[model samples]
Target: MDAHRKQRQAQHPSLTITDMYNVLEKLRSGEALSAKEQKTHEQGLVSILLQLHTELDAAVAAAYGWPANLPEEEILERLVALNKERAAEEARGLVRWLRPEYQNPQGTQQTEIGLSTKTKVAKATAKETLAWPKTLSEQAQAVQRALQLHERPATAEDLLYQFKPVAKPQQGQRLQQIDSLLQTLHGLGLLRKTELEQYVK
Candidate 1:
C-alpha cells in the first residue's frame, strides 16, 4: 500500500488528501478538470480505496476468528479430512450440500454415486462416447456386415478382428456381446455356424 501511494505521489507530484477531497467536491458539484488531471486524481483515490478495503476485509476476518494464512501442508490435510468426512456422511444419506426440501426422494446414494474424480460412467455412457451402435440387433448387424465385407466365413476370433474405416473400433472388451449377437443371429437362421466358423446368409 505504501509503495502504491508513493508511486501515485511520484506520478502526481502535487497530489494530496486535501487535493483529492477538493477534486471530489468539484466533481460532485458538476465542475470539470482537464482529462489527464482527472485520470491521475482518480488513480490516487482508487489506490487509497483499494488499500482501505483490503485492510477492512482483514479486520472483519480477524474479528470472526479467521486466520489470515495457513501452511500449505495444513491446508491440504484439512481438505483431505473434509473430503473423507463428506464422503462418509454422504454414504449414510446425510448429504448436506443439497437443501432438505430439495433432496431426491428416491435416494441420495445414487445422486452421490460416480462423483469421485476417478469414477467413470461405465464406458458406454461416457460423455465423449460416439454414436457407435450398441443394441443387440445393431451389434449383430455389425458382425454380419464385417463378415459379408470379407466375402467369406470368419471364425469367432476373426469376426472380433476390427476392420479399419469402421465407425466403432475393435470390440476387444465386448467379445462376449459380439459372441452373443452371433449366437442370436445363428438362432434366428440369419447366420450359419459350422464348427467355430460363422457364415452370413
Candidate 2:
C-alpha cells in the first residue's frame, strides 16, 4: 500500500495558481512551449482535473446524504472527459466570434470609422425617435422579416441598400423613419449599440 501511494504521488504533481496562469499566458500569446513549460502545463492540467473530480465527488455524496469514497483512478478518468468537453465549448465560442452576425458588438449605434480616438462624444446615441406604427400587424411583419434576414438594428441606409428595387421615402424622411424603428427596437432590447456606432442584433 505504501509503494502504491508513492507511485500515485509521482504520477500527479502538485500545481499552483501561478503555474496555471503561466500556461494560459503562453497559450494566449501563441508561444511555443519549451520542454520545461510543456511539463508544467501538463502538471497544471492534471492538477485541475484531479481537483474538479474531487469536488464533484464531494458534491454528489452530499446531495445523496453519503460520504465520498471516490478512487484516484476514477477521478483521473472523469477529469480527462471533462477537459475534452471544456475544450469543445471554448472552440464553439470562438466560432461564434468569427460569425459576421455576432462578430460585431450588439450595442453600437453607429460606426465611427474615421473618428479621432480622442473625441469624447459618442458616435451615436440610443435616443428613440421611431413613430408608432398605424397597424401593429405591419410593424410586426417588418420586424420579423428584418430578423430573418439578419438585418436587425438595420439602419435606413442598410435597408435601402438591401432592397434597392423597392421605392423609398426621400433621404430626409427615410432617415427619420429608420431612427423611429431603431428607437422602438432598442426599447424592446432586440438591438443594441455595438462598438463605436455600429448597430447589430
Candidate 3:
C-alpha cells in the first residue's frame, strides 16, 4: 500500500496546501529546482491557485471555507488584487503584467489576464525571429539571481535587466523573447506568476 501510494504520488504530485506552501517557499528562497521538479511545482501551484479560484465548486471551496456562487473570474480578480495589495503593503514584490492581446482584434485572441508588469515595461522589438538564453535552466537561473538581488519576486520587466545582456537580443528582436521566456519559466516552475502575473523565483 505504501509503495502504491508512492507510485501514485510520483505520477501525480501532491496538491495539499502544505505542499503548495513548501513550493512557494522554495521558489521564494530561489532554491535550485530540476526541470521535472519545477514542472511539478508549477502544476501544483496552479492547481492550488485555481482551486482557490473555483469558489462555486464545493469540493475545492470547502478547503478554504470560501462561499460558493462567486464566479471564477471574480475569484481570480480578487486574488490578483489582493496580491497587489500585499506586495505594496509589505514590499513583497511587484505584480505581473497581463497585456491586452485582443485589443487590436475583436476577441480573436485571449484577453491578457492575471499577468504582471514592472514599474516600467520594456517593449519587444517590432520585427525579429528571437535569440538568447539557449536553455530553460539558464533562463531560470538568471531570474532566480535577479530575485535574490532585488530581494523580491521579479517581473518579466525586472528580469529583462538580468537576462538581456546575456541574451544580447539585438535591436530588432528587443524584448520579445524575454517576455515569452518568462512565461515559459513560469510554466516550468523555475518562476511563478501570482494570479495574473509572472515573478522570478
Q: Residue pairs in steric clash, candidate 1?
A: none
Identify the superior model by lDDT, candidate 1 or candidate 2: 1
What lDDT would candidate 2 get against the real structure?
A: 0.45
Query: Listing every candidate in turn, what is its Cα RMSD in Å to the true structure after a full C-alpha superposition?
Result: 25.7, 23.2, 16.1
TM-score of each: 0.29, 0.27, 0.27
Model 1 lDDT per residue over 29-118, tens place? 567777754775686874464444444433322222234354558656755876897789769866643322235455443232223433
Rank by lDDT, highest first. 1, 3, 2
Model 1 CA deviation exceeding 4 Å by range: 1-132, 163-172
Cα deviation of 114, candidate 1, in Å: 43
Instruction: Give the deviation of candidate 3 from the true structure as CA RMSD.
Output: 16.1
lDDT of 1 at 40: 55
In candidate 3 the C-alpha lDDT for residue 144 amounts to 42
What is residue 133's positional error in candidate 2, in angstroms? 9.6
lDDT of 3 by residue, 1-201 (tens): 234334435667654445545655566567877775567576564344443333224322322223455677988986688577656744643323333232323434331221233311223332322234454434433434454455466666665554435535473353554565555545433344665574634
